[model samples]
Structure formats: structure tokens, C-alpha cells
Target chain A: MIGSWMTLPLVLVAAPPPPLDPDPRASPPAAAVEADPKAEVPPLPLRDARRAEQAPPPDVMRAADNPRVPKAKPGPPFYDAADEAVFRARFDLTKDPAPPPRTVRMRCLVADPLCGITVEVQALSAYALRAQQGSVATANARTWHSARAQYDVWVQFPAVVRTIGRTRFNVLSMGPKGGIVASDGGDLWANVGLAMRAFFGKGAFAPHLEVTGALAFRIGGFTEGGAGFFGAGRTDLGPVRSPVGFAMDIGVGLGGFGSLVIGGQYDSPLAREEVPESLRTPAAGMFYVGFRGNILWGAPAAAAVTTHVLAGRLVVPER
Target chain B: MRAGVRPLRGRAGVGYRVHAVVILPLASVLLVASLASPAAGSEAEAPPRTNRYLEAPPSSAPAGEDFGPFFTGPPASETSFVKAPRRGSGLAPRLSVRDGLFCFVEDAHCVASLLASTDVGIGMAIIGENGPDLPYAQLTFRGGFSLRPVTLYRKRYHPWALGLTASYSVGTGGIRLQAEDVVETARTQATRIALVNQLWLWHRPHAFHLDASIGAVRSGVLGRDERIHDLWGTHVELALGFGGWASLVVSGDFLDEDTRIVFGFRTHALAGVPVAGLTALGLWAGGVL
Candidate 1:
């Protein structure tokens, strides 16, 4: 009899219920956390309120747009606030998100070099990077197919400029205008020449001045161009004064702003000819040390593809 | 072979020619400098912001483009400073037809020719512009091949070609100059060799391809007097391309008294014949290859 009763209970458990509503419905789905790429999100206003006592209702959090999870009572944080503060301190830009970024670090992120989209994320990450600066995220630059315009550069912050020599940048920034960071965004001696790779990989035209000297030898009977910034250090105009010489040069180039340049030339006496005729001298080409800034303006050689990626870490415990 | 015109009687102290090197250029540069603001203070402090914060992540890519983890950045709008200008170049052989307007400033003459390719090519400078000098210096066409056995520097895909150009010419430029005509005839049958460097400079706004070359050209000429002299000289050419198919070329043969500069500033179709139909001091049209 006891066995039959147990069997009867088992049968009861196995029996299926009568049909009710045909459609299935979720009890309360959670909202996804992601920002739209094209969402013109208004700035999150700064709040200086004290920590709240009550946590937000779970239902409200699950349904509300632009929801904010209330903070727990002021107790020791889940992790070291000081350590997080130090990490945050490491990043100057992790401050309030107003129109113009406050911290110089954030300024660079918003202005040149780093993309501004991740400022909020970076703000949160300032705390997480405390342990692993290595986990930092990076984006690659677009590729330049043209060789002429593919000069890239990474300018160190606070560039050092000197006379007739030396070179240097901060964070893949094409600090062509020297390392000086201006609020209005202009630099002196803007960095240029000698390409440095960008965060994203693509090459940016440098705005810095570049001076170069190159030796050219004609194959069998090699020759060079004459009279301009684009010209070498020789002039072979014509017969009576076919003055040829070794080239000495001082050239200056403007990077991204405008690819303008001036190259001065002075051929070694080894190339200048002084062939004198009876009463008159052939036009031996005036200005034995001629310089060419002939190239007034040249179009930007390559395309600039600005690539920005949003990646970083934020630490929080499950409610 | 040719003679010289005495530098204008008595007044010759580096006159107008000096303008090409000094004076005007200096004045122009100064004018530009006067208009420009002195370089702003070197170390720029971030703009003084009374209220500054991160503007939202521009919501999307700073430029207007669909977002993918990795894709080409935004296309520059018409007003954007950056642009995309592709340099047009290929392995396809260019069949160029050219006309050389020789001694336009001094003799008012021209030559016509046709040439094709990096390998075997030919040119004929047989066209005439003004008639006064054709009879004295009839034109000739020549053909040959480029012995470009090596390349100097190549980046990405653009190659710097160091070529050995060799050719043979059989034509007439035997001059019969009168006491009054200030003309130097370049008529000869000669062997030519040149070192040619074809470099593509920039690829934006308009592509600028530069064909800079220097070479030796030797010609054996028998004058009307039955006297023979081997004309020897070297020349250089600068061809800057503003298009994928056309370039503004300025070329001249040096070591010759009657050297005339050839200028080709004509437009061209990337797939069609490239021609430079105008002349300054040399020929109206340069090589048509």
C-alpha cells in the first residue's frame, strides 16, 4: 500500500498541466550596456552628491534608459581607493568630461594623437590600470598605399630644438610643430621628416622642418636638375658656361601644414668653371652658391585616415 | 657645330639672367614673411579652458563612416584638409608621340618623333614649326632601347629606375648660316647614351612623377665644308607629372652652344597619346612616347 501511495505521487509528478497562455514571456530582461557608434550622447553631467543609502530598484535598472546604478553606503571600496586614485592620477585626463578636456593628457586624447571617444572609458580605466599598464588598449592606423606621402612620425611631448642638428616626439603624435602643446593647438618647429609609426599604423605627413643632403653620381654620364628647392647643387645651363659643381645644401621643409620647402645649393669649386674669352665672359651662371625654394606649394602627397578605437577596462563587483 | 653672338655690345654685367637666381625671389619670400605671423610661442599650453571636459566620443568615428573594428578612416570632406589622391602608374607600356621645337627663341624651329616603351624604342624629330631653318637643318628620327639593368631605391611599389639609354641617329642638321641669322644648327648622325632616373615624387592633388636624367650624347657631324667633328655633350631632363599620364617636362642637352630646352606642358589621357604642344626656348613638343 505504501509503495502504491509513492507510485501515485510519482504519477502525479509525471502528469502534465493543462494548457494556459500559448506565448512565452520573460520575467524581466536586463538592458544591454553599449553605446551606439553614431549616438550623439550628451555629456554626462558632473555630480558632487553624497553616496546614497538605498540601491536603485532592480526593475528600474532593467528598464530605464540612461540608467545609473546607485552607489553602496560609504564603506571601504571593493578595492584600494588610493591605489585606484593613484592609477587615476597616472592619467591626467581621467577627470570631468566637459566640452574641452581639462587635463593635458585628456587634451591630447581629444585633440591630436589619441581619439577622444574613449575618455569616459579611460576615466574608469584610470583605476583599473593600477595593476597592469600592460593591458592598455591600442588601435592601428590606416594603411597608405602611396610611397611619396607615406611618411609617418611619432613626436615626443616637449620637443627639443637645436641649431643645425638633432631630432626627436610624444605618443605617435605627429608633433611636427615641435613638442610644444598649445591650447589653441599649434607648435613651433612642428615635427617632420623621418617617419614614426602612428598608433594605428598609417603614416601622417609631419609638419616639422627637415633639412637633408644627398650625393648624386651620374651613371657613366650622370647629371642633376638645376635651380630650385627641388634641384640639386648644379647648373648646366649651356655651352660657354656649363658650370658643374659638387652640391652643398641647406634645405627646410614644412610638414603636414603644407609640404613647402627651400633648398639652397653651393657646388664645390670643383664644379664651377671660369672659362674667359677675349673681352667678354660667358654667363657662367650667377650665384655660384645658388639656392632653390622654387617649389612654392605642393599638394598633400598622401591621404590621412584617422582611425579611433575605444578600449579599456573598468572594475565593478556583481550586485 | 655653331658660332656665338657677342654679348650685347659693351653692357654685360650679369643682367636679366640674374633675376632667375636672386632679387625677385628674395623680394617674394620677404613679402610672404611679412604677411605671416611670427611662429607662435614654441611651447603651447593647452588652450586655457575655463570649463573643459571630454566632448562625448563624437558619438561615432570623428569622420562620417560606418564603424567596423578595422576599416579605412573617414573620407575627407571637400573642405577637410586631408585628401586622397592616387598616383597612377602601371606596367603598361606608354606609346608616346613627340615633337621637339628646337631653338624656338634663337632659330624658331621644331622636330617630330614617335617612341614606345622601357625596352626597344624609337623617336623622330622631323616636324617643323617655322620654315626659315628647315632647309638648313632638316630633321631626323632615331630609335633604340633602354639598358636599365638595375634599380636604386624602391619603397612600397614605386621603383627608382636607373637606366642606361642608348640610341643611334641618322638625320640632317647641316647648317648654312648667313652672316645675319643668329642660329646654330644641330644636324648629325650620332650615338647617344644617357643615365636616366625616373622617380615618382608625390601622388596627391595631382600626381607628380619626376623623370630626372643625366647622360652623355656624342654626335659625328660632317659640315657643309666637308669637315667632321664629333659633337660630345651631356644633358638633363626634369619631367614632373601632374596627371597619371601627362607630365610637364623641361629637358636640355648641355655641352652644346645651340642647346635648346624642350618643354612639354600639354595634357594627356592616361590611356591615350601624351603630347606637349607648346615651346618656350627649345621645342614646342618633347618626346611623344
Candidate 2:
């Protein structure tokens, strides 16, 4: 008993001093602490820790000195200290919650965006001193797509020689029942067309050909006046201005006419661009073999017709 | 086996002219008789205008361009993939098939399937005789309409299409099909309704198109022991052609657990009309009127 009493005094003196309260709400009044200037003050846990590890303290005023922030002015104590009791009582007693979620900034490299693509640069959250960059990969994942801009340069390549010119065309005139018709020589008809084709794989694709099937359209019977109540009289038509629709099909050592172009074209009735009220019969589904080389270039020839009427085949209405 | 797939496609022979001779007269007579009826009547009054120069030239339009319009502008130098819209319309021969044999769905006996011609006309296909499995079946005949009414494309190179077909086939043979539990045997006629989705890859230089379609097929038999088989079928086709208006087609079809392939060649300017189409199956020829 005598020895225990002797060591108790020494053990109590060696123990560490109790830590100060870190929470502002748990702190005593400033006046009360001011009276004891020598008392050690508690350090703000989250605010000080994050600041020390991350960046320099913000340049803007802190919550304590900011004019915009509410001060502890004695009267009415901010919340009728009477009615807001429960709401205020439930508030957390921690210093500065988690750091604010990162704010992002986006920038582009070019203004006009040439070479066929638009590029964007963004700056994510980072630590200045440590020079650590935040992740941006997830957000940029969905930026690529089929509609994205593209650039291509054609390079000359040697390709095998192959025969060109082998398209079939049906040029026929139908009377009321699709028989041979000779009305005023069956309304003399002529067709001239031109097309510009961008060949892809060199030789064969040098001029892309457009292929179409029958009038897969069921317009509810526009020509039902035919024999036995036949439905559609016109064959299904594709575009009249296929990239390579009209070629220089000059008959050299062949049996075909000098000008052979079998494609869909519209003259009037189906015109979608010009004056809407113009209801002329659309010259569609006719297989025409133009022997005249009156028109040499294709673009002007195509523009000549397309400008007047719709390209007979299948085309979307103008926006 | 849809009507618009491939019906009569195979290794073509040198009988290109012979094929045309047989179908020409038949088509002419039929067309003449049909024309004897009356001019087709339309609800609208305006006549179809075939003249592109009907209107006087505008100051800027590229009309009266008699010589050469070659070497155009910006569109020429810049190269990009083609992007086509949905809902495209096109016409083909009356009796064309993309793939999946019509007769193969039931017998795969006497005849092979016909490939749908890219041309616009009417056609027929008939194959005589069959294997021992369908001894009674003397021949098979099928005909119908095939159309590609809806088409979508990502680029000119990647084309997608939806095909609608309605066709009828008659096989004069005993339906010798032994299912898991039931056995069916009898002579009957079959009708097929099919919708197929197609993917077309274009080989620009050769003017070649490689296409494939897959979809649902319903083969319905009309007879005493009528039955229907619902299944999926696929068809693949390779077409080669020169620019302008002529092409050779070879296609393969797999339907009703059987495979059939056919070949054909089409010429545009021939025998009076602007277009002439000939098929190897029934040796039929039809042209646009």
C-alpha cells in the first residue's frame, strides 16, 4: 500500500494533456477564450489536412471573414433560436466536409477544324505542386462514331485491265394494256443523262454503278385503269442520277446504240423542288437509248435535268 | 424461299442468244393482247412529262451543256464514305428471287431456285424431274414479285436493305417429310412469304456487288395434308457488271435445310426494247414496258 501510493503521483504526471475540442459548435465563446490568451487552440481537421496535402489555401476570403457569410451577431441568433431547434440540433459536428467534386473545363485545338475532324482539349482537376492529372478517359470514350468527320487521299495503284460496259436496258412502249402503242408514233421520247462517279477500288470501282429493282412501291393503284384491273403500270424506278448512271456508251465493236443509258428519271408530275403546283407528267421508268453525243460532260447534263425535275428513281424530298 | 431471292441462277452457257429468242415472241404476244384492252387510266389529269429541257434555261443552271462537264469541283477531290437515307424504293423483275429456294423448302427435288434479277421485268422458272425422294413430283414451277422498298446505308460501301417478297410454287410430288413424331406424305402446292434484311458490299472497280440476306420464311402447303414450316433462311449473291447497263449474276440460297445456286446475265439494249432480261431456269425472257 505504501509503495503503490508512491508511484501513483509519478504516473499521473507522465500522462498526455487532453486534446482541445475540434468542432466549432463545441467551442466556447470567443470572448471566453480571449480571456486566456495562452490556451492552445484546436486545429481544423479536414480544412487544414486537405490544404496541407493539396494546394495553397484559397485566395478568396474564408468562411469566417467573408462578408457574404453570416456572422454570430448576438440578437435573434440567426434562427429564432426557439423554432429551428430540432433542425439545427441535427447538424453534423465535423469541420469542413469532403472536398468539392472536381470542376472541369473544355477547350478545342482548332477553330475551323480542317483535315476532316474536330478536336477538343479539356483540363481536369490536378494538384499544382505534385503535378497530378485527373482522369478524362471515361468521358471521352463515346466521342468516336460513324458520322464523325473523315479525310482520305487517293493514291495511284496499278490494277488489272477489265472490260467495262455491260448494263441491260428495257426500252418499250405500252398502250392501254401494255401492248405495242403507236399513238402519234407513240409520243416520241428521248433521254440524255450524265453522272459523275468516284471510283473506290481503282479500276472496277472507278465508276460505281447503281442497281435497282422493280417499283417496290405500292401506291394503292394509280394506274388501275389497265386491263383486268391491273394495279401499277409503271416499273419501280431508282435514281435517275446514279453517280455512274450515264456513261459514254459509244458503240464501237458492239451491237448497242452509241448512247445507252437505262435509268429512272422524272420529268414533271413527281417534281418536288420547283413550283409545287406544276403537275406535268413525270417522264419516269422509260428505257431510253440516246444516240446523240450532243452533251459531252456529265455534271452539266445531270444538272440540266435534276435542276428541272426530280431524279426519277428514289430520292428524299428537299429539306 | 421467297419469290424475289434467286430462282434460276447457275453456270451460264453460250446460249445467250437462244435464251432471248424463246422468250421474245411470247412476251410480245402477251403484251399486244394486254394493250388491246385500253390505255391505263389514272385518277390524276396531268400527263407525265419526259422532257428535261421543257423549261427555258435559267442564268446559272448547267443546262444546254453540249460538250463536256468533266473535271467537276470540290466533290471530286474530297473522298468520303457514302451515307444514304432510309426508305429507298426500287423495281426488279416480276419473278425474281434473292435467295432461299422456293422448291427447296419442301422437296429440294426437281428444281433449283432462281436469283432475283436487278432488272425491271417479268419472268418464270420451271424445273422438270426430281430425285428418288420425291418420285411422284414431275416438275416445279414458281413465280412472284420481289422488291427492295426500304434501304439504309452507313457509307456507299456498307448498304443495308429490307426485301419484301410474295410468291407461289407448285411441286407435283409426294411430300416425304418425317418430322420428330409425325410423318407426312402427299402431293401439294406451296406458297412462301418472306422478309429479308440484306447487307451489300460494293466492289467498285469490277462493278461487283456482294450481297447477303437473312430473315424469316414461312412455307405453306395447300393440299389434303397441308402443313407449314416456319424457319430462317439465308441467301448470298455475287454480281459482276460493266458500267452503264449489263451484268452477270451468280447467287447461292440456303432454305428449308437445303442449298441451291443459280446464274444469269442481263443486257440492257436488245431486241427492240430498252431493256431485255433472260433467265436460265424456265428459259423465260421479259423486258420493261
Candidate 3:
């Protein structure tokens, strides 16, 4: 045990004594540096060593300052809070809502030629778009200018003919029943007429006018002669009669999509009475008042063709 | 057989006797008249002067006139002549009267006459004269007036007259046969009125009358009890009148049913004045009135 104790002392003596200074050389230098009023400092090597221990790695510093880097403003918050609420209330965005496509519609109104106030309507489709265009427009800068207004006029040609068929004349003399009486024979003939019109205005406030003309042919009458009671054999009194004439009409019209028109016409004999002996007799004048209307399938302005119906009262003045 | 023969012989004998009796008398009369005619002619040709004494004489003869006993003084102006008065004192007074046939007036200044008449006719609707079916017949009635007055100094031969006619008709003659029914009953009726002026052109052996009427006609039909009425149907008719008091009138008329055209003729007989004593017979074919 005494030996073991002696070995332990030796072993203790063998262990290196605690160093009074961490590094004899480092301590002296550090002490010398501390002690010296102006010591020549070991610049490069020591400065390098101190910097290596204290400075952060480049990657770590980059990571730490990343939040402070200037960022894009997030772009006006994708959508406002109210906008989000509206979107959610109106549609189920999660379900993917579909968008409505664009569409366009157009219409028009038309007028009758015979009666100005008559309006008709017809259904039109895209096929009629080109024909219905009222004017061509061109854009200059920001303003659109129309080239010209185009008008489509409708005309009516009468299919049936009518005419003044016959005329009977009488003469009154000085005595109550006194006078030589004469009469012309009855005649038959045919007449043809044409009408046209143009309208201006919109909706129910539109106004229009129409003009019409008709030519009648071969209207004449015959004469007869003496008989009994007159105290002699039969003798024809007047000569043969012949008459041809034309009539004119003008009228004002007012109406809307569908319209009704009423107007009057004054007709004067265009030719003189052909009966030589009957010239002394008074001439007859004719007149008529008529009503006309249009039945339209749709809007008046856009219809391709409209049906017009007419009725009238005819009158002829006494000779 | 013997008895039958006896009766036959007796009947023959009687017939012969009657024939002889009739023939002998007629022959004798003819013979006597033939013999007497010559004698009468001879006596007439040779009148004896002795017969003069038997003739009635005298005061019948005018003075300064040679008078045979049998001669009557030129029958006192056989042609009566009325002497013209100095002024208007002898003028014939006007005559005016209204009768069933006509209205007549005769005056020195003017002669005026007016006549009004009405006629209604009904005809049978029989399939055959003795057929076993009965349907409604057709009936027509017409009434009108005529005015004729002779004006002094007016054309002497031509008479101015104005006539007005308004007639109504109801019957069942307008039915048309269809595929479903070979013959069907149709009830038709019409009402019409016309004002016509008759201008007499000739008044000799025959009178030529020209007349025209402007009028309205309303017609309807009940086909198996379906009513179809056509109003506002206007028509004008022209007619030619011919012959003497017995006159023929040809007329053309228009009706509103599909605007059909019709024509017809009528004959009339007259006696007396313009307004009176007239009768008419008429037949028409074409579209129904």
C-alpha cells in the first residue's frame, strides 16, 4: 500500500503542472501588447483569426435579411372584401360559373303606297338585314357619319277595272211639262288605276301622303226617236254619245305600326261629252270618300310586304 | 137471224130518208136565190120612170137644187165643221178624272195623265205535272205608276212619261241540286224598287219606248233553313219598248248574287188613254232577281 502511495505521488508529479499562462508565448505577447504603450500589433494573422471566429456565414445572413427585402405590394389585394362577398353570394365559384355570350336584335316599320296613313308589318330575319339597312355609316376618328338614307317605295297596281257605265239626260222647258226630251243610250267600259306613297316619322306620330290616278275608257250612251202620243212616227232625238275620262286623288295620312286613313277625292271629266246635240246639257262631276287600313304581321317598318284593305262611297253630281 | 136482218134494213131506210130530206131543201133554196138575183139586177138597171110617182117627195130638197123624188139634199154637211170663234169663248173645257187604270185630264192648254198599277203572280213548283211530291212555288208581285201628259207645242209624236216600280217577291224556287241531294228545297225572297223614265220615241202604228231604272235590290235565300241575305245590291236596267198599244219590252238587269247579270222580255197591251186600260204579259229567264 506504501508502494502504491509512492507511485501515485510520482504519477501526480508526472502530470503537467497547471499552466500559469494559457500559452507562454501567447501570454507574453498579449501581456507585452497590453503593457506596451505603443506596441507593433500583429495585424494580418490575428485580425484574420478574430474575424473568422466572430463574422456570420454569408448564406445565414442572406436568409436572416430576406423578409426586409423590398416586396411588390401584392397587387391591390386580389379582390376587395365586399367583392368577395358578392361573388360568393351570387355564384358558386367552386362549381365554375359560365359566362353569358353577347347578342343583338333589330326591327323596322313600313308604309303603304296607296294610302299614306296605312302601316304594315312583316317578320324579318338576318337574311333581310342587308336589304333593310337604311344607310351606310363610316367611322372618322371617334364619330360615325351616315352616307345617305335609302328608301324603298311600294306601289299598287289595281287588278280589277271599273268604269262609269251609262248616263241618262233630261231637259226641262218653259212649260211645266213642256220641252223636247232626249236621252242617250247606256254604255259599258273599263278603268285602270295606280297609286303610290312615301312616309316620314316614327312610331305613332308618323305622317304620310298618297297620290292616285285612274283612266277610264269607252263610256257612251245611245239616243232614240219619235213615237205615238207625240202625233208622229218614231224619230230619234239626240245623236250618239261618247265619253272618256281620268280621275286624280291626293290624301294625307297619319298612323303608327298599324294605321287607318280616311280621305276624299274630286274627279272631273277629262274629256268633253261626245254627243254633239247633248253638249248643251249640264256635265256631271264625280267624287268619293274612302277609308283604308293596313294589317301587319309584325312591326310596320320592318315588314317586307303588308296587306291593305279599302272601302269607299262613290257619288256623282246631278247633270 | 131473220129478225136482225129486218131491223138492219129498217135502220138503213130511215137514214136514207133523212139524208134526202136535208139535201132537197138546201138544193131548192140555192136554186131560187140564183134565179132571183138576175131578175133583181135587171130591175135595178132599168128602173121605170113610172116608179117616180110612188116615191116620197120634197121639202127634203134644198132650194135651187134639182131633186129626184128619191134624192136627199146633200146630207146636211155630212162632214161636221166647227167654226172658229172670235176669241176663246168656244174652247173645249178641261176634263180630269181618276180611274183604276189611269188618271186623265184634257184641257185646251194641256193634257196630262197618270196611271198606277200593281200585279202579283204565283207559279207552281212541281217535279212533274202529276208527280207525287209537293214543294213551295214561286210568287212575284209588282206595283207601279205611270204619268203621261201631252204638252202643247211639244214634239207631237213623243210622249213624256215617268214610271216608278216597287216590287216584293217571296217564294222557294232558288234551290240548287248538290251531290248529297239530287233535289233540294230552297226558299228565296227579294224586295226591290225602281224609278224609271219612259221616253216614247215613236207613236205611229207602233211606239218605240226607251226606259232606264236605277234601283236597289235586297235578296235572300233559305237553303234547308240557312239564311243568306245580300244587301247593298244595286242594279241598273235598260229596256227597249216596241209595237203599238201591244208593246214588247226587252230589258237587261243586274243582281247582287255573285253580281249575276239577267235579261228578260215583257209584252203589254193598252186601250184608252195613256194612264188607263193597260194589261201586260211577261216571261223572264236568267239570274234570279
Candidate 4:
């Protein structure tokens, strides 16, 4: 009796069995057998199915709008459609064949020794295109690349100065109306030079030759009709005149890493001066020792201008 | 392999985060405490007292009859010259002891300078060396002139002064032995003199002074067989002054391609005394000179 009770509890805990299938030979109901074949089957859209299969993956489509997708993968930086379009236009990626060669034009303004401005242009032939297009045609075409050199010249203007030098004369008997007179005028002066430089190790040495010229004028007058004129002689003088003279100079500059320049210039006068027996004049062969230094505010050989201060002393050559 | 490496890195990251959290606050607290204590002490020592009469008595009263003459009445105005009434008179002689390390551009070794200045008047310095037994010893006599006269501190004209200095240095050094085997001992002596005529323009606000100097210098070096004379050169110096009258001067002297640097300190002491003291302590530290 206890075994029977346990079997009953076990049967209650188990699930019910599934129903058996109907036999094939069994007939169906009249209404179900009479259903139409056209109503039962739905038509498939072939074009839509094919298009869906050929489309890009869903992740790729999603990534087109998602920025985080690019950060997850290591590759070139991602660009939006507008940025990509701009880059494509700038680089001109659509061109099939090579474009014409580019023209390079250069212009320079050099100052030092002399002030000058220069412009250059040049034409370069496309070597590859020579097989397809004749040289004559390429030369005549305005669309071709070219470079040229032109407008090379130097312009210099004289620095003007007006100054007086010391005069020596003994004081003598003079009338109340006696006075001294002096005159000064402008002179044109210019210096022209060329330098060849060589740099080695930590030092730069340049050998240069320079030519200098000056146009000068001076006028002076002495007291006339002094008190002693009746007793002795009349004291009177006229203005003295002088002409311009050209000078030639040669020098070499020794420079180092720092903007240090030391040079010596020898100058020889092209003309001699005529002076009275009682007057003293400077000798012809006068040389000047010059030293210049620059503390450049920027990098060397750059376009930035440098400030340089120069000091010179003129030494008279021994007669 | 990946699983094992992952936990190690995770634990290391956690450890770093913990260390950062613990160290930052502790370091900040210590820094704040260190900076605040000195400021607090300075404030406590000079508390702002509203009772002018009671607070003024301790500093102004005479402890004895001799001190009675020293007490002048409260200054008539902020710019009044209560410290020293007379100008140009009651100028105290200054004595200074200076010591510092020095280097030269021409030499690899560094030397020390111990010197003193005895002031006969304003803008005058008499210096002599007293350091370790060096290769040379020098005696220098120097004097300077102020373009603007010295006035009492509070009544002084906008802290502007210009000056010129001239110095003469005489010294003797040991004979430098050459490679030659013969011991040729000669008079190891030299006389170096420099005349630095400068114009100094200075402007001051409170205890701070900014100064600039430009001048011409003439220096000469006389040796046994050679003499180098610099007829003319350029000198410039920029200086800053702080703490009432203590100043730091940085000077550069250019002679041809050579340059010299001079660094020094100037101090003014004994503020209320009749003869105030001026001291210059430091060195003409470096460069070719």
C-alpha cells in the first residue's frame, strides 16, 4: 500500500504526453480541402530582395553617422563628407594624367656693399610630354610652365654730410670792422665693393676690394683793411676752391661664429691737392682701419634685418 | 596568457590611483602649513595697534637723559627728514667686508675674493683683498661721484642717482713657470687700473629700485714684458634693489672681443643714526676681467 502511494505522487509530478499525429489515409473536412491555392501563396518581390542582399553591411551604414566607430579602430583619422570633399578637391585626385610642370619664380632684395633688387623667372620643359607634343608647340603655349630672370640691377645714392675742420692762424693787429668768414657745401660720396667669402670650421674669412670716391668743396675768407694797413700792408684774402678726388680701397674681412668683423682698408687718393707754401695739408695716402660687429636678433641668412654698428679710424701713412 | 596579464595590470593601475589620492592631500597640507607659519609670525610680531599714543611711547621715549636729545617730535609730514636733518653733513664713513667666488674667462680655474671697502665719503670705496693665499693679492682705490646729490631717504628725489667710478688696482702674483728647465724667477707684479665714468639713472617705488648705467672705460694691464692698454671701451649695468637699501648689480664691460661680468651687493644700514653706514658686499664675479 505504501509503494502504491509513492507511485501515485511520482505520477502527479510528471508532465502529460503530446498528442499523436493523424494518419495519412484519414480524409480532411470539405471546407478546408476546398481552399484556393492563389489565396494561400503570397508573391515575393524579387527586385527588393536582390537590392537588400547587395547593400552595404548594417555596421558600415551605422558607422557613416557614428564618430565613435573610428576611434575604436586604428587607422587614418576620420573625415566627414564635407572635409573629405575639400581634401579631394585640394589634392585634385580625379586627374588621370600628370599635370603640367609648375613654375618657380624668385625675387630678392640684397643690401650691403650696395643696395639692389633682383627678379627672376625661368621656363622648364616637361620631359615626359615631349614625346606626345612637339617642342615648338610646347614653347608657344602660354599654359606651359616657365621660369625667368629679369630686372637685375643695383641703385645707390650718396650719403650727404656738411662739416668743418679746424683752422689755424696767428692773431694780429686788426681794425674794429675785421671779421672771419667760412663757407661749407654738400659733397656726394659713394662706396662700391665686392666680397668673396669662404667658411671653414668656426671661422669665415672674406677677401674684398672696394672703391670709394668723394666730391668736396670749401670756401674761406680772411680779414681785410686792418688798422695797420696804412702803416704796413693791406691784409685781404679771397675764397679758396678745391675739386673732388677719387680713392681706391682694398680690404679683407675676418669673421667668426659671433658677428665679429675685423678689417683693414688702404686708400689712395687719385688726385693731389695744391696748397700755398705757408699752409699745411693732409698727405695723400691715408688709410682707415675699420671694425664692425653685429648682434643679430634672429637666425643667420634669414630675411630678418640685423643691426650692425661700425666704427673706423683714419691713419695717415708715413711720407 | 592574456587573462594572467590583465589582472596584474589592473592591480597596478589601482595601486597607482590609491597612491595618488593619498600623496596629494598630504603634500598640499604640508606646503600650506610651511608657507603660513612664517607669515603668521611676521604678523604677530607687528600687530596693527589703533592706539597711536600708547603704542608710540615705547618706541619714542627716552630710557635715559642722553636719549632725550635723540627724540624729535613726530614728523611734521610724511616727507619730512626726521632721521638726519642736515644735508652733506653727518655723512658716516662706511666699512665693508666682502667675500665671494670668482671666475675668469681666460682661465679654467675659479678663485675666491675676500675684500673690504672703507668709505671716506659718499660714493667712495677703498678695497683690499684678504682671501686664501692666492697667486696674487691686490689693493684697489676707487671713488665715484653722484650726478644727483644724496638726500634724506623719505625726502629724497624719486630715487634717481647717476655716478662715475675710477679704480686703480696694484697686485703681485707668483711667477708662472714655463716648460723650460731653467728657473727664471723675476718680479711677479702688475698694476691694473680702470677708470669707469658712468651715468646711472634709477627709478624706485617703495623698496624696489631699477637702475641702468652706461659709460666709457679705460683699463690698462702692466706686466713684466708686455703691456696692454685699452684706451676706450664700453660698460653697461642693470641693477635691482630690494629690502630698503640692499641692491644687486649685474654689470658687463666690453673691451674689443672680451667682456667682463660684475655682480655685487650694496647695503645701507643704521637708518636713524646721524652717520648712516653703507656697505658693499660681494664680488666682481666673472668673465675676462
How high is the TM-score of chain A in each model? 0.21, 0.14, 0.24, 0.19
Alpha carbon deviation, residue B107, candidate 1 (Å):
35
| TM-score, prediction 1 | 0.23
Tens-place lDDT digits, model 3, residues B153-261:
2312124666666644433323222233222212234556777767655322122457777788665422232224344466465655432111122222244332323
lDDT of each: 0.23, 0.22, 0.27, 0.22
Which segments of model 4 are wrong by more than 4 Å? A1-319, B1-141, B147-159, B169-206, B221-225, B242-246, B267-289
| Candidate 1: tens digits of C-alpha lDDT, residues A1-319 | 1232223222222112223232233222222124344434333223311112132312101111211323223334432344445645677645322232211232221222222111100000000011101111343212211100011112122222121111112223222110000000000001112122123211233333433322211001111221111112132111111112212222232222332323222211212222112211121111111111111122221111000001101112111
Instruction: Put down candidate 1 lDDT per residue, B9-101, tens digits, no spaces.
Output: 111111212122222323333344356432212224212211111011222332222212221232221112111111111111111111111
Native-to-model Cα distance after best TM-score fit, residue B27 in candidate 3, in Å: 58
Across A158-235, the per-residue lDDT of candidate 3 in tens digits comes to 222111111111111010000000011111112223344434432233465555454332211222321111112232
Best by TM-score: 1
Screening candidate 4 with a backbone cut-off below 3 angstroms (N, C-alpha, C), the clashing residue pairs are: A120-A148, A121-A147, A121-A148, A121-A149, A122-A146, A122-A147, A122-A148, A123-A146, A123-A147
Model 1 CA deviation exceeding 4 Å by range: A1-319, B1-71, B76-155, B166-191, B204-206, B220-228, B255-260, B265-289
State the lDDT of candidate 2 residue by residue for B81-115, as single tens digits: 11111010001111111211111111111012222
lDDT tens digits by residue: candidate 4, A1-319: 1232223222222122222234233455456567743333233356555665665422111211223222222223333344545655788754222221221111111112111111111000110100111134355321221111000011122122111111111111110000010111110111112122222211122222222222111111221221110112232221222222223222233321112222222222212332222122221212222221111212321111110000001111111
Better of 1 and 3 by lDDT: 3
Query: Residue by residue across B113-138, what tens digits does model 4's lDDT show?
Result: 11111111001111112111112222
TM-score of each: 0.23, 0.22, 0.23, 0.19
Name model 2 segments beyond 4 Å from true: A1-319, B1-158, B167-191, B196-207, B216-289
Tell me the DockQ of each model, to 2 decimals. Answer: 0.02, 0.01, 0.00, 0.01
